[model samples]
Target: MIIRRFSGIILLAASLAACNQPQGADDAAGKAAAEQPLTAVTATLPAVYYDSLQVTMSAYYQLSAALVKADTMGADMAAAALKYHLDSLPVARTGLDSSRVAQLAGQASGISAELEGMLIDKNGLDGRRLAFQMVSDQLYDLLRVTPLKNTAIFRQYCPMAFDNRGAHWLSDKTEIVNPYFGDEMLHCGSVTDTLRF
Candidate 1:
């Protein structure tokens, strides 16, 4: 009887230990993750495409920064550089897989067209900002399909831009620097999406 009693006590202690132990570590982890900011996930791209995108995004970032500072000439120059890179993209070059290059090239061509408009737009800074928005949209679409590894691209939106029509732009930073309003309203937007790979 004593042995049986001791066995029962041991079993009860085991049960109580388990009951007192942490029950939902996984649930807690999930909840923590849920509370965290979203990390944009996207399709992986080949090295060539990745390199090209990095270069293009670099120029686009420069253009955006220029606009944020209200530097019209700097923005124009950066746009020209971006155009050159887009134009020089070898969609069917040796070593690069031609299958995906055509599609990428098509998207890039559209971006180049938008940049051209920015280069020639005579409606002053507002016109250029509009053109930049178009370029940003194209880039955003392209990045959705082929995001570069180790890059964080923020998709920002401004409801007051374009006469309240609202607009979106991509930024390399998380801070809201309104390219549309420049110094007039430098921090006039919020990041709506993030693209990372």
Candidate 2:
């Protein structure tokens, strides 16, 4: 681990040093070429859906991090942001059939409702945590029906959560960061399922 860190630092320093060097005309032209945005290729799924869904996913990750820290206020704020994005997600623009689009929209609304519940419950952090389980489940179901392009989603579970009743959460990575237990047992979960399409 230490060696890897040292090697990474060396590589970063090399990159920084390279950046400070004077660039020739050829180098400038090459840089400009590299900076050009690649045109979106035609795919079965629409690119607009991917971009909009990415924003919602980013907000979901922020909520997950807040929960991992046991910060109720932060979690509430993040969840509010997530709910806002979820409510605004463009299911109609996803290029799915009418029935599929309706299903996806319903699932998104379900997750948004859970977030609202988490935000309003008098039970505070526990309520938020409780609602998160359903939110995760709804997300998993949504993904199973409506696949996202070039994305891998992990369904992680903590068996020790809620007195061994077990609960599942979706993560973009396989690493186990238990949101249910927070710092108490951060690594008490495992990746039980992976979805990529």
Candidate 3:
């Protein structure tokens, strides 16, 4: 991801991806989150705004889990929820400088458009994956500015995605759940970066 200076340092969010479960994978995932519920953003924003962003992140995690399972219906549902959160983000109310606020707003807009593209009636599975790739990219940019409050977030990547064009996604865990290929290559990615907040 492109590194940008916010104040005097570069900004970032986390690393991740998740899809098809192996037996009790759901149990494991849930347990991990229960152990460390990263339910807020570090940005100085109103509580309601923070809750909105938290739900957005939750939806994104759901989308990733569905992708790992190659579950189209699930992905559709999660994408819709994500779109709502992205659209309603209250960036202006956040206690940040003009540049950072504008950056988050622009990225949120990009994320909304990408999620919409993913939900188009004719886009199908491949289209959804492609759109998710963009969403992941834009999310990465957005997270750079609006850091999530968590112990650690991993940035996962797969050079084989999109016919080797490559793709990246954020994860709360260190495991690799390749959303692009889902079950076919669920573990195809690797951790590229880790952010702790």
TM-score of each: 0.72, 0.75, 0.73
Ranking by TM-score: 2, 3, 1
Candidate 1 residues 150-196, lDDT tens each?
Answer: 87999887766776666779988898787887877677666777887
Q: Choose 1 or 2, whichever is better by lDDT.
A: 2
- lDDT (CA) per prediction: 0.76, 0.77, 0.73
Highest TM-score model number: 2
Residues 108-168 of candidate 2: C-alpha lDDT, one tens digit per residue: 9989999988888847777888888888877776666656678898888776567656677
lDDT (10s digit) by residue, model 3, range 1-197: 23345523421111122222121446446645664322334446677666777778888989988888888999999999999989888888887778767767877988998888778754778888888877876786566656666446787878667865567788888988888888776777778777666
lDDT of 3 at 84: 92
What is the alpha-carbon lDDT of model 1 when measured against the actual structure?
Answer: 0.76
Worst 10 residues of 2 by lDDT: 34-43
Give me the displacement of residue 130 in model 1, in angstroms: 0.6
**Rank ordering of all candidates by lDDT, starting from the highest:** 2, 1, 3
User: What is model 1's C-alpha RMSD?
Assistant: 18.6
lDDT of 2: 0.77
Deviation of model 3 at 125, angstroms: 1.1
